[model samples]
Target: MEKRIVTVQYNYDVAIVGSGVAGLFGACHMDPSLKVLVIAKREPDLTNTSLAQGGIAAVLDTVNDNQEDHIRDTMIAGGYENNPDAVRLLVSRGPADVRELMELGAVFDRNPDGSLNYTLEGGHCRPRIVHHKDSTGSEVQRALLAYVRTLPNVTIWEDSLVALLKKDTCFHLDVIQEHTDLIRHVNARVCLLATGGIGRVYEYTTNSKIATGDGIAFAYRLGARIKNLHYIQFHPTGFANKKDRETFLISESVRGEGGYLLNAEKKRFMQNYDPRQELAPRDVVSHFEMVETKRQNSNDLWLDISYKPADFIRQRFP
Candidate 1:
């Protein structure tokens, strides 16, 4: 028989699982009086959020872009299958969120005149992506983590995995510390699962190792109806490095910023499938890649941006 070490159960007003952008951001907005507990399955910084390279898209400039345009673009990208009300709300409220991120000390790239330097990405008609060079998500996470740490009412525990969850009058959680294998019980009036995507389940993916769908699994067990499991979209461009299971993602912004996609023959083939070519939505581009691969009988593809000036490339990507 094994001797189990169990700690006393602690209570919190809100228990947020996973330290990705969603978790950290939610923690930042919690009322200071409410005791908040954030649990991370690994080091807080190592999350899918940190792996995001492309900038967030929002209609920050109303002069050239508007919320309706943003909503339309999103709907088109989603193949018109998205909820209209949700898209409207997101597009309408997104600029304020971006402004709030800036208020929280997340610095994005700016123009020489001091306005936000917005860039373009695949599936968008406007240049509305505000980023910190190319690592927008990391910058956002860093700012949120820093702000969350300053809140005395909030606590962050890394390397703590939520093994089991039960709900009664309140929510109960069984947490296992990865380092010491110590078990601890936690109770929270509210439980928010911010666990990210289910990418690691695939043979090859660009998603972070922590994206194992833990939150989705927990939600399903809690009687939440799961749908659209088959809606997984493959990225059109990833570095074909056979060495690692996780291929490096070539950001869609690359194509948005004039990068070209070439097939095995070192010639562009996207024109044959879609007029938008490289700028097509991810699913469309990914589908055509497969079709072109079969036609060419080779998986050799290239994303070329070397034609741009060295200084411009460095300024945009770095």
Candidate 2:
């Protein structure tokens, strides 16, 4: 771990310690004159952003959707526990952020008229999610990565791990190089951690190998306030395959597009509890599934969309 390449030191105006959508996009939007460094603990493609199958939720179309509706829906989905300021900011700025994402070369699914296509999801009052089929996150990440690559002031370091962080006058990070097994100390005016969620702690999760609470741990160590760590959002319909802990997530859009939630007995469980049936917010569905699974003494839950036409599934998810 103490292997050395050189004693040379480097400094940057900003250091982003994750190459996900947030870090890449943040770097893309930074001042071109400022020195920025983006670090990824593994291959750049291993982020949870690249694993997202569902689309982004925002009011991209005012003709059918509005900010108030989006905000209300988001707050309701969060059980009204979301920070008001954060929700306000997200609902207000999310559309522009998405448009900027498009201007940076993101290609989203479109309707026959060539307008951006929108889809419904749990807790959404309108079909406001703009996606690139089922690979929306990967598509957005690809575009941001391309845009950031063209910026001359930004440097990307993949396979670099932020081992520890210390702040005196500026933020100092001890980065471990995976290939060389050497430590590099990076000093920056600001350090941004978009290292993603802690989903890997769960026995079954759709998170990537990198989502091991690293960012939160670092933030807590640095005296940053960590709130809502207990508020984990679980998807109800992860494919319950055998042995593999890294469960594959069937997109939420399936239920949003009218799928059915069934128990081991092949009974529709959600309609009895909510008027929305399978289209409740993910957390609500997860809780319901948990209760039902425990009550039934089984783990065989399923999501079936086979009622839809075969060609439609291929076209919609292809």
Please tell me which predicted candidate would have the highest TM-score against the true structure: 1
lDDT of each: 0.90, 0.89
How large an RMSD does model 1 have?
1.2
**C-alpha TM-scores of all predictions:** 0.97, 0.96
Give the alpha carbon lDDT tens digit for every residue of 210-231 in model 1: 8889999999998999988889
Give candidate 2 regions above 4 Å deviation. 1-8
C-alpha displacement of 74 in model 1, angstroms?
0.6
Give the best candidate by lDDT.
1
Q: For candidate 2, write residues 1-318 as lDDT tens digits.
A: 554465346799999989999899889879888999999999887899998988998887998789998989989988899998999999999999989999999999999999999999999988999999988989988999888888999999999889889888999998988878467889999999999999999988998888898888998999999888888887777787778988887899998888898998999888777887788898888888988888889988988899999999998887
Positional deviation of residue 287's Cα in model 2 after best superposition, in angstroms: 0.4
